[model samples]
Target: MRRGAICAAGLLVALLLPAPAPAREAEPRRAPEPNTLVPAGAVRYAPSGFPDRIVATPAEDPSSGFAVAWRTGATVDTPWLEIVEAGDSPDMGAPRRIRATTRALTTENGAAHHHRADVAGLEADTLYAWRVQGGGTWSPWRQLRTAAAADAPLTLLYFGDTQNKNASLTTRVSLEALRHAPDARLALYAGDLVSGGDGEDDDEWGEWFDATAALRSLLMVAPAAGNHEHFEQFEDTPRERRVLGAHWPATFALPGNGAPGAEQTTWWFDFQDVRVVVLDGTSALDMGTARAQAAWLDGVLAGAASRWTIALIHQPMFSPRQDRDNALLREHLLPVLERRRVDLVLQGHDHVYGRRGGLRAGQATPQYVVSVAGAKQYRLSDAARDTMAPVAEDTQLFQVLRIDGDALHYEARTATGRLYDAFSLHRAAGGARRIEEHTGDRIGQRDCPRAATLKGRTDRCWE
Candidate 1:
């Protein structure tokens, strides 16, 4: 059976299985086999590196400022940036090195080391080489293209979810996205980065990061927290509030523009012409921070100056899944987005792909997207048409967006890079909006077709 089928089956098993025995361990204790590959020959030229969760450097203007964050197994008290502009000629001489370090952070997930070095003092709209290094060996030099000075034209990659078996199949999707857009300015992850929360023992995060090393070399990652990142109740508090034990905050340097309590991951950043807002859907709905985040979000929207606005988070305020529409968030967030004329709202949680339109206050259409990027799969409801433009069930997918002038082109490509759906949102000089959807190769009404059965798998949800 196909991997998706197996995943579907596994999920079904979980639902069908008897309640867990009282002896079940609170934390799973499976350690992945160590990876010991020495870079040699052609391997030395590969983009893969030692540090896991390797992510790109993001600057206010990507062409001018460049920053990157990486994690190491051991402590690196001091970390720095080694960067230089590569000339047209091969002999670009040596790079100029700048040093910096992060306050050491050790979590229950693992011994963690993180550093963010912003390389300034450079030309605009240029390609530069850079990497991160600590006390030990410096990372292999990687290339990055800086952002344009102002209103620069660029392409940004957006993905739905990569929250499954990180080691085997999830990597393929992430690697494929990087391969498709090696020079993409930045990447937006719409949450569900891992399958579990503070119980950091879940191996999916490690696997997801391990597979996206090459793409991480030049991409800045902006991730939102999905429901899957939530953990069950622990002690008197929930796991989501318990430091979020995984490498969440340390893995990425997100803008801290959220409410008082949830500041690190929930923030907004401007990429020249676009204002990107990230929210913690988990916190909004379950953490009692909805009122706070919603209040702050309204303020941010009211004061925004960017020409275009985009918000990314985990749960879909609108989904094709039955009873999955986040009414609370919709009540709080949708009005602000509509009032702000938000261009795009990217989200993932329903494990399906959908794009709805004709959005208004009470009876809204599917103008937002809910996608899945892992081995997991879910079924779409027939009523999805009420809220979803096009829904894809039981398929792993990613979205690539290209911004050129007033036209924002969006293509929802599957894991295999198939342009399953395409559309363009044109922002006219008159401040009017026009949406065009292409139906030539459209994958009709998504449903989980009869899939081959995985022999020994206990999960059947994906099938």
Candidate 2:
């Protein structure tokens, strides 16, 4: 037979074999117990006793390190993690098993547990797989790609408030944002990741984790603690005060480089030429974290070596509501931020969509934004209108940031991927910054229809 005829026969023979179907993921995890407060069958990805709420928060140096946190049943103690470098082959060979630090967390639902573990000395720009184990059961494998080398362009997704709506309902915004940017390195939660204060409201957190658990499993999250996630008084003991939510600390493994008293709650980390600093404004204004956080903020910015520096907080220094203002943040934190000349600030609390490049000493210094991801919406009252030109009202939005050496491009999109606002910060030759606005097709503002009620449920009109 000729060569062509022989090759054709082999191809015909291979076609006789069947291709295998892909493996299916297990039932998505859910809340351990029902949250009766929320109506039955409202909106939720129920939590399971098995490993749930998997998340990786950026470590001090995200280039070669990362950390994960998860939850399990109280009965399952001694949480553990198994990790390995992934390969093209189907079987992932012997993974290194490391035991995690477990803590018992009793919530409104019932008694459950949370676990966390930090992995360091990882290879830069590598791919790895990890899963947790409890009660002799292991979670499905999830893969993570480490940060690229310094000087490389970086991209990340930013979210405002995911509070007030069903945990699952609000989660769609994050998943939607992630779907739009397949190459996003990390996700930023600018506070109010969950509703219900003092961490006693466990059901809501379950919604948050279950809604975006799959996405969070792979990407590192640079998060800030929001006011709704903390409170000075708890219902259990009205007289006593809690610095942060009961479940906040046990939820994620964040960086340790923070103020003397604020560790993971308020910390800073470096990732691919970008320095991210998370500040606890709740603690700063109400408690005694102002001076300390301010001092630490100045020090961090003073010694910052990254090309871009960004601050993430819960409350905005420039309030969008006429009734409210973060006076302490303005008086203490703003001075340091101005002095340091931080590039961008991401914040929540006002639940309105607004941005500004307020002038300082006759030059555009920093870009500040207050956005919301969940269904709750608030009308923008000025957003420091004198400083912000194109402000918005009653919107649910997310932001995506792209960073290179000289410019940082930002886009604010609605939950359904509608671009409402955009801007680019260009660095001039001698430390001067210029802002360019890009307001694409947008609904601009949302209004309550004649017969609509957003009192308890997430408003679907925005979506």
Candidate 3:
């Protein structure tokens, strides 16, 4: 028989065969769901106990590397890595495994842990598989693809706040974003990855990680510190000590280059042709520390050599929610960004979705946006008329960003993958930023949940 005929006949035979026995089922059972909060005296460590967090290093070196992080109940036994080309395969399947060494360390939380297995020796624009070893057991292999090394067009994933109902619906959004933009080089989270403050329970953060498991293989996260990350001050605590509770550095190994006085809270690094600068708005807004990080922002922006400069922080200067505007950020950081002509600014905390024309210091650079992911919803204020674009309310959305040569394209997608807003920024040889808007046919509309339609009210309107 011909090759095509034989292939068809083989498929027919497979279909004609009796169904496999129930005992031969291959679907693996889901991970155990831990109690939301540990009992008063239980161990209460990381619920999933898997190597939980992974982030991409924004290095411009030949040895492109991504940092993989996981917390275990006990010391990991020789954390190893397995790698293979990411391709069409079963959810769990055989892959080539390689041994990678692990280091041990301890944190203030009384958890003796291991760190530093920086996965190096990776090819640019190539997909690689990896996993961690917790003693005799092994973790599901994670897949990661490095960004393109040279100056070329690239794509990335941007999310606002994945803080509310994070475990349930938020994971859907993150997975969908990855599903839609699988090759996204990096995923940027503009703060509020969780709900609690510095004394955060590891389990809460685990939910955030769970929401993004499907993309964990290819997506390396870069997270900012949102207001929710700040701890409330006790009476006797010193002012500086009360600001941030030091949990951030313990969790992720971020670039150490931050504002002079704000080293631990602020940072900036370049990736390919873009320089990403992150600041702790809680410090800048709470106790008048804006000047210090603002100075650092100015210096970083002025020294940037990348074609595009983007700033990611928490609070928004052009918030659509009345209760959450950041007057201090507008006064401090905006000037530095304008002076340096930064291309994009991504912020969250308002729980609403907004994309506005750029503001030099207080006036309107090229593009500024405040958005939200997860289930939290907020009502849009009347200030929508003051901006160039529309202000979205009662919406949970994610953004897919594309950088093609001299232009950048942004599309805001609803939780279910509907495009609600679209815009672009163009960079000319030497000039001010030019902004253009697109009204695509992919628009969607969602209204506030009616009382009868509501499930249960915790806080916001979407309840």
Give the number of the best model, judged by TM-score: 2
Please provide, for model 1 over 157-181, each residue's C-alpha lDDT reduced to its tens digit, 9 standing for 90 to 100.
Answer: 8888777665566677887787777
Ranking, lDDT, top scorer first: 2, 3, 1
TM-score of 3: 0.78
Winning model by lDDT? 2
Model 2's lDDT to the true fold? 0.77
lDDT of 2 at 143: 87
lDDT of each: 0.69, 0.77, 0.69
Q: Candidate 2: RMSD over Cα atoms?
A: 15.4
Per-residue C-alpha lDDT of model 3 across residues 95-179, encoded as one tens digit per residue: 5554544444433244545434556666777776767756566677666667765477778888998876577778788877876
Error in Å for residue 99 of model 1: 3.0
Instruction: Flag clash pairs in model 2.
Output: 30-46, 30-47, 31-46, 31-47
**CA shift at 328, candidate 2, in angstroms?**
0.7
Clashes of each: 25, 4, 9
State the number of backbone clashes in model 2: 4
TM-score of each: 0.80, 0.84, 0.78
After superposition, the stretches of candidate 3 with alpha carbons farther than 4 Å from their true spots are 1-50, 54-57, 60-63, 77-114, 119-123, 197-200, 235-241, 360-364, 442-459
